[model samples]
Target: MELKLYRAGWALALPAVRMLLARRGRGAGMRFLEERLGRDWQARAPGALWFHCASVGEVMTACPLVRRLHARGAAPLLVTTNTPTGARTATRVLPGAVGHAYLPVDTRRRVARFLDRFRPRALLVCETEIWPELYGACHRRGIPVVLFNARLTERTLRAPAWLARLYAQALAPVRGVLARSEGDAERFRALGAHRVQVVGNLKWAGCPADPAGPPPSAVPYWAAVSTHEDEELRLARIERMLPSDAPVLALVPRHPERGPAIAARLRAAGFGVAVRSRGEPPAERIWLVDTLGEALRFMAHAELVFMGGSLVPAGGHNLLEPARLGRAVVVGPHMEDFAQETEDLVEAGAVVQVDDEGEAGRTIARLLADAAARRALGQAAAAFVAARGETVLEAYLAELHAARLPLDRAPA
Candidate 1:
């Protein structure tokens, strides 16, 4: 069945290959594949496992696993990610591993070419990325494919029946699934995933920020992480509503490109300001850490954090990042993407959900007024994450092994 699927997918190669001549910025993903993988790409790696993470979050989750594999003598494991940001994070964090482009859009030929070249013993896929043709091609070549930290949302559950059926068929090629939570496992089963198991969120094991780093001044500040335009604007208003004696604000925009624009908006709003990444940390002004790779560090420095993506309908960003750092968390109403985790935190007094910026500001003011209450909330958040531990890793590694091909050689 998988072979036939791959055969049908082979037809997509014409368009995929043509991607090379298309506009560089547009269809660049496909173009990248065509340009990078030349003829005879089926050459196998000497001794390596392949881990595919779609973006920055998944890259962070896969870091510990990659290190564990290295400790177990799996050197030179190949890492692949679709986004430029993911690639940068992987390269920066996964030290000593070979990094490569992800197999291009599910065209059989592209997948085949990729497998032939990387010839990894096994393929570990993070989260919900399932490419039928890619998995089918791997199956055809006797390579194992596994889905790790898999998750299926309520929206995914309520998909049109036909679409769900199609998705089930698409997922049929993978050998096993390591779901991030019990809810995730149940959803996968409802959607026809086999060999599914519940693994706690890998975010629990996310690397901690260096405590030795210079301490941010002991000012009463709240962090707004991974925020978008709408959220940022709303937060600026919230900041304004705070009492003049309130601590400075740490606003980390999700995209670095928007830093200047955000800074301008904040300044125009009549708030004294400093941009952290621009060497402008005003001793008594708001600090906009317009940098990347340090959201968690800032969280550690914050008295409280309002997670981003919740303000608008973007399905909230990771609240666990702050929770794990022992910070009191506040979030906007929209969190369907991480419904279960967020709710759990709320129930445990680890998080507070506000309807809008007004509520967020009010909540922060309340917490700021009561230091003991804030500490208590932060403690609970930390405890919740610590309890989850490495359960996610165990389940994911188990599933990956189920589909693993024999290792060509151990790392020396």
Candidate 2:
């Protein structure tokens, strides 16, 4: 009954959702709209593995997996993302042969159109995507579905009973769950998911080669990467609290598209700002890194890197992105999203976790003042990531083999 209500709710809200998509899909052209509606002119050739990554973060993290799959020459691969930004990341990062599309809205009818057209053999839903209709439709077709890099946060575990019931139903058809941690596996089990296994975090083994180059400015700077809007005001406060000429702050907003607004906000707050997407040179106060796919470059060059999404209610982003780069990384206390990664890094002194923006400011100041200490933290981060080894990909491939997935043969 709960699942039925959930679908009905989606059905009723779909009109408004279409308006919302229209707004989001502005200037994206007609194909974006077509794909989101589960009907597109792009006739998908059926011989390909399919992966659904909901957003930019998942799309970026899925690169390593996609590359591994692409290398095997098993089949053509198709990746669907919910947002245009996610689609862009898939296009930019995934190999040229891979296909990209906007995942249709999760109504049974729309999802059926998508599934029927592609006829995917197996579907790997990245992270926490639990679209009931999508899962149910795939299951009805006998498509093997796996939840990759799966996690069930405490916050999500505490969802209302109705949601829990709906999720349990959604997960029923899921064949396997590749959890990122034991705690995650336990939570999935408690939530009624079957065949859960702890396969480690795939983001831990991110891009092997960094596109990092020299720091944009000769002036020493520290970066706050993937920051949210709410946290932007806090960063403005933190910057004001710092000394007259503290290392220039490289403020990289989580959504590069928001760079203009963020830069305006920081400027109105009385800071000199330079917009990178506009080709402006680095400013004395803040360098707004508003471009996509270049976060690692700034992170690699900064004196110390502060991760965004942590200081605010927004769940933290891929904290390990910078950690793997061997940079002095710090995050705010709200790291519920990446708790295991933060915990592991904190235990090894590879990353600093603070209670609030106040502590973050102090930590940034202290680290900026003491280069040797910052370098020590960076070295520890490097060592910890090195210790994690490169087995996550192999572990996932093994899971496929155990499931009797014919990676090297035509789909049966």
Candidate 3:
């Protein structure tokens, strides 16, 4: 079987994998190992719980559960993130209470070592992180795994039949699944999960704490948040079309490392650009919010926001941040992931949908020009977020509580 082969492959490659991981540092593979073996790691309280969040979004979604776990005396909430950014965000959010680590490569030995050392009470898997060796190791140790805020898009369900079966095999050890939506629950059932509950999307409640201090600057601004490479250039084009009297434009690149290159491109196209961390706030044109974690701060001040990833192939970044902050919202045509939420907002006249760069530019320009329209949209956006958020978060907490009860006393 594919699953057996995968386990065997990891077992066979353990030595080389260990060697490779040992040298990889905190950027990726061995980061998890380093943190696991770090000073405080061994000092963790007994019977602590482990929660795996795949990346930034998953980590954001898991915060509520992590908070609840810690409140219930689940000391040493072991949190692992696959991305460096996610690790940074976790540390920022969880502070002194949670342990941050990189997730090891899903090799059998590494997973076994990780589980044996930590011996978590229960494993809460956020979103769709279905690691075969990891789950298998957990099963062997009688640890229950729960998938919280679970979802399966149409694209996932449309994968090859063998791949679907492989997915089911990977998740077989999971005790319960808390799906983000009814559609997600149906997909899990089709893929052969035993128990799936249709909890609403967890993102509805995922707002980071408000940033301390005033807006970064006094300049009236509008933000283009989580903008991708393709979307960034398109945004520059949009900026050119705006009236000079319009508010300052803040462009936050999704990847901070890409900031310089994007700034260069935007400058070449004749826009005045100020990279947030470096330059003084320009009296004239765009504010390039090229720093990490500051986009949310900038979003809190913007008059209108264009959420990115939707502009291109990436499904979309979380839009709730901008909406919850009561900013008028605009997004592109490709938000397959947040399509339901986006549609709901658009129908309520809270969010503006645009087909491409031209439309995006015009929509933003119009929103800026009409103060009344901006105010009405902002109110609508905030209301939409408030109405749906608590319902989703409470349901997810209930599911997490249910999943944790059975695994709390397993002989580890």
Alpha-carbon TM-score of each model against the true structure: 0.79, 0.85, 0.85
Candidate 3: pairs in clash: none
Best by TM-score: 2
Candidate 3, which segments miss by more than 4 Å at Cα?
8-40, 72-76, 83-85, 99-102, 153-164, 207-212, 277-280, 401-412
Ranked by TM-score, top first: 2, 3, 1
Badly placed stretches (over 4 Å) of model 2 are 41-43, 154-163, 208-210, 228-246, 255-283, 286-294, 312-315, 355-362, 386-389
**Candidate 2, which ten residues in sequence have the lowest lDDT sum?**
403-412
lDDT per residue for candidate 3 within 279-345, as digits (tens), equals 6685657888888778778888888888989889898877888888888889999888787888888
lDDT per residue, candidate 1, 124-191, as tens digits? 88888867667766777766777777887778879767567667886777777877778889989989
lDDT of each model, Cα atoms only? Answer: 0.73, 0.83, 0.77
TM-score quality measure for candidate 1: 0.79
lDDT of 1 at 33: 46
The lDDT, on a scale of 0 to 1, for candidate 3 is 0.77
